[model samples]
Target chain A: MVERHEVRLSGSGGQGMLLAGIILAEAAILADKNAVQSQSYGPEARGGASRSEVVISNTDIDYPKVTQPEIFMALTQEAYNKYHHDLGPNALLVVDESLSLTDDLPEKSRVVRVPIIESATETLKRPIVANIVALGVLVGASSIVEHEFIEKAVLNRVPRGTEELNRRALDLGFQLAAGAVGGNK
Target chain B: MSPTVKLLQGNEACVEGALAAGVKFFAGYPITPSTEIAELLAERLPLVGGRFMQMEDEIASMAAVIGASLTGTKAMTATSGPGFSLKQENLGFAIFTEIPCVVVNVMRGGPSTGLPTSPAQGDVMQARWGTHGDHPVIAVYPASVPEAYELTIKAFNLSEKYRTPVIMLMDEVVGHMREKVELPDVPQIPIEERPRPTVSKENYLPYDNNQGDVPPLANFGDGYHFHVTGLTHDQTGFPTSAPAKAKVLYERLHRKIENNLDDILMWETKDMEDAEIGVLAYGSTARSAARAVSLAREQGIKAGLMRPITIWPFPEKLITQYASQLKSLVVAEMNLGQYVNEVERAAQGQVPIKRVLQANGELIRPDTILQAIMEVK
Candidate 1:
């Protein structure tokens, strides 16, 4: 059985959705699985909603984009509403609880409300790293890539000493992932 | 002089590679998506004693490239969609006369005046059949910055190797993206120049295949003064209506590429061994497809991606090999369905071939591909 998986992260541009996709893709590649990552935003750079998708496969991937995602992560109400109808029948969705989204979800789909923005602010004292918090939830949902690989990918991408803050955020993410996976005791 | 790689935009890399490949002449009209190629070349060529001129328009730019190439100098030109349309007639001339030159088409959206600043793979078939006629053309596409550099060098080699017009079908993303590209050392890149005939003016058959599939070209002032035209011709450089001679010349021109398919064909494959579903894409679109295949595999779906680095001549052999095991094949391109026909035809009746197409002047994103895969999933 081939392992084909996609993770889509949507939020306002500065929420680091694109960077999260890169980190995930890099982690998958570090795991030696075939991976592809891409992102986009509107004419606006900072405030406009941005989206990113990543694919990880045991074999070669044909279509690059995620037409339908099995797991979706949204950081803002606009992103949550934008991609609400795109969630597959059995897809898993992770969205910020603080964002007011009132849409009805598909029957086979499951929505997880996480305090991503609040959590990022509380732990790292910044709202920007909420993507990593959401990404932690994705790792909990789908073990597509190893968390250790993600840590190394983060270290490899960020500047020399920014690791301390990222490590704190990543440790919290590890806890979140464990929680999502039922504490895997 | 240095053995380093810099992640460069496709256009920047092409200019650097073109100059290093002994290209001393450049003439182009600046159009969106491809202007950086000319801009870089304009700045750098003069430093290397190369001639770089901005022509009045695309038609003149193409003509200037041909004119410079005929004089035994490695020459080139670049343009986007409408500029490519303007160069079609002369492109046919390059095919008929077998002039060795490279044309870089940094593809943008449209048939007429489409999205100028946007990216599109709409020119795949246009690069194949854009110039009206049954003549041979060599086309290559680069998915990333490094390949863009490597392939631009290869394009010059193919042009000189076969004495035909070679095209680099780079899109806006590759053309503009600036990354950390480690440029390779000069000695590492084995350069090949065109075979120039040593035979005197009296006995030179400009269309002769006996001198190899490509006859050694003699520059205009090389004491081998011979005529080159776009009409049907015989062995001598003169135009002729003789059917047998016309047939012979036509067959050889086509064979230079056909016979070298093994060497000319380039592609990349992902998870194809047991893939029930296959995606066939080229250029910028393939970047997304490569990721989607991996995602599909994680979800317990058997999928693989096939991206053609060489878009023309359509990698039929490669496609046929994967087509046998696939339940369905998808051809995703920027335009409506131009290249999808070739993919469908290559698959024969073996499986269902479909197109997940887009043309609203936007790059085909990863989400659209996930939707298509789930349809089959």
Candidate 2:
């Protein structure tokens, strides 16, 4: 298992990528690890590209920004084209199945095309929970954080009375990732 | 026993710290990077019977804070670069009147609204001299989210104890980042309140120096009718243009903080006991400096870091002491060069001082700092 992992989640403004980053960081803290989450977005309230980065470490974390991400997940084609080249060596590039991969992908990075948005829309029938679905997929594929802690964090953040909906969305996400990778650790 | 650990954003930690420090009033305008400080306080303050006001503008927010503080309430206002610029006039007013309030400037890139979403340390000089006149200032910068929590409490403490407006300088990175914070219990947190008048209301002198450098400040409504203004005032709290009285008031304002340097100055040193090169940094840049110092040590170059938690009255003595011992020094910050000049003055040409600066809305990376460290002969 990687002792220090940097994860970046990028999409449009309304996609909830920031909340996903927060949940991931909260999960890391719940497991007694150190984590830092930060984000950047344009001036618009929605539709503009947004990115949130989380760094998880067993030891102290210095230089809070993500320099080289070990895990990169992009839900939009614009975000994918902009950031997929900045991954670390032997890193995992997770993107939604909706995005078409370019030939110039990083040489040593592995690409996992999971149906992140589709799982939220078709399987869970709640398009807003796509960020949580993406979180499930990323954690399911990389095992950077435990599923139980992520579940607790997701439950802690979601709106009241929507816990059951988000739980199913997270579970569907895990299933999609497992199907793509043959099994989850 | 286990401590209460929660994953908190830097802004959230600041709110927690303010609430813990007996802050009863918050008046601020919503601005990027620092808006969360106001947002969280707005939601949290009312629940605790504290008042949170979304003022008309940054100036009004500052005025409201000073107004609230005069009533013996611990008040604060948070803003970014543009709003920080707007608050300067009233900030000077608070300083001139010796009102106890905290102004949190979560710094972003700028002379204007340079980068709303990015971090910069451009306000180091502004925090000291942004407001006009030759006056003493106390500004503290924290590098991490946990430190943000701890330092917010310290800001309120210093403000109340000195009866001045204390500036809490936070870069956008520290304001927006999230970290796990092990919060202390209510009983464990130390709180300080402003000293109140012991004499009768008729005999009360708001700016009495005979009592001490920081006299007992009587609240406006607490049976003490004292006058406050931006003009220079004497011990009786009335406007006085006389040179002697003006000189005495000005000197006391500076001396109150300068004389209490032992209590006001807070800093931390790492790997400095036996080092040839010293790096002086603060806020988010200090975190990068720490990594660079460690990397330099691993490369067999003796390097150390002196991070000032309090930046304003300037850590002159500490910087001078380190300058004498080290062969060279490096001043790293997000701005092109603000506090570096202060470091140079304190060093007094004792050693060569190098600078690592960036102002394009990005952090100064550790490797960039390490490269500078490698170049120092």
Candidate 3:
């Protein structure tokens, strides 16, 4: 029953994907699982491509970075194109509806297309918590980390006075992931 | 405050470790992969009543730490590759002056800002000899975020115990990696303070050798009039070019570490009780090497791992002893043949040395290291 899961969150530098990675790892730790999070970003503060990787295991994690990630999220078209080919077989590829994938993806893979950004702007009224929405969707689909721990980590990490907004955004993500899972069939 | 368990980045662990080690002063310049250490210290040091200053440059930061240490403050500074280069002169000065301070170099791709954000072990030899002349260094490397916390505390402890500069050599991979760490209770962990001079002011010879090799030091403005110079000095603490005095000073500096190898050396070995091939690794690469060793063993290839936690004192005795039982040695690192050279020297043609090197910022994969282990006869 001791299993290892690798997740990578890719997006632009300002999208808070790196924070999402941290939250994911923290959630895994809260659930009594071993976890590590690492990130790679370009020099630019906003427009540059950013990628954060989190690995959760029931035992000690040796290699922290995800190579062929089982759970990969690409919030931007650039991130999708750059990382689409590196998915492991039967992997879960999560992407925003804003990114159109023209290239062929690996066979037997599950692609969850969620309106993460759109939901953040329209429903949450705060586009800044889109990363939390993405986190909720990932956890909702995979169950690599529990929903309660992810929410706890979010509350611990988010800026003061924004807890309610972030929690709402996370719940919205969970709903979106549920809808995406239903629609994918 | 009760001990708390939290997920912390390697840099954050270092800040906490430095805090636990009784570090009251930190002077550093922000650099890639290592800037977070300074940033966290800026926020956390004040809460603990420690002072944190961002110096104008790496050199000034090094100089400031040395100045602060002279006043009996447990001071430290953190920097990356290029900044580590800039700190060499002051580092040498501290080595010559026998100042107790911790210098953190979170290694990045080097040469000249080679790859600021990428991880590299290009500073391994540099940590040993980046400074100009003959000196003894005690540099320790951590392979995990929690070890980053533990070894940082050890770095400060070693610096104070030996009265020398201790380098906490971290790479980008470990520096930036976040892991869940249980902080040790502060009251339970042992903290060391620098040895103080026992003699009265009139008899306080700053460079006095009448005591043991590590002479007790007195704070600069604490009722003691002492001269601290980079130049060679004698028992009176005055500059002297006398042949006998210079020889004694130089030999003692080397011997203090050389004679105490047992106290300074630390390493970790796995499944090596009866193995033909030994994989030698350190820092981030050690993780990969450990995996490779486990995989090789699973495949029925009798392989083992010898990882050095205390890197700079070289752990020659362990390498030599381990080499005696091995048919071949595989040295794996993020840099190209940095520590392997030391292994080659220690192995002394006793076994074939195979190097698994990756200097382009990316970590060496476990499969690649396992491939090397498989290829080894």
Candidate 2 lDDT at A31 equals: 85
Higher-scoring candidate on DockQ, 1 or 2: 2
- Model 1, B1-377: lDDT tens digits are 76563324578888878877889999999988898888988998889888999999988998989999998989999999899989999999998899999999998888777777678888888899889989878899988766787888889998898899999998876676443345765634677788888887888877776787889888877788688888888777789988888888889988889999998888998888889999877787887777677678888999889889987777899888987788888778888888888888888889888678998877787667767988875
Better of 2 and 3 by TM-score: 3
lDDT of 2 by residue, B175-263 (tens): 98989887877725578888889999999998998988898998888888889989999888899999999999999999999999999
Q: In candidate 3 chain B, what residue range of length 10 has the lowest lDDT sum? A: B184-193
List TM-scores for all candidates, in order: 0.71, 0.96, 0.97
DockQ: which candidate is best? 3
TM-score per model (chain B): 0.96, 0.98, 0.98
Per-residue lDDT over A26-121 for candidate 3, one digit per residue giving the tens place of the 0 to 100 score: 899888899999888447436767889899999988777788899999899988877677788888878898888754767778888889999999
Model 3 ranges with Cα > 4 A deviation = A182-185
Q: TM-score of A-chain in each prediction?
A: 0.88, 0.93, 0.94
Model 2, span A1-185: residue lDDT tens = 43678899988888999999999999998888999998884463367677899999999987788988989999999888877777888778789988887876556677778888887888778899999998888888889889999999999999999999999888877887788874211
Indicate the DockQ of the complex predicted as candidate 3.
0.78
Query: How many angstroms is residue B63 displaced in model 3 relative to the true structure, after the best TM-score fit?
Result: 1.4
Question: Residue A1: error of model 2 in Å?
Answer: 12
What value does DockQ give for candidate 1?
Answer: 0.13
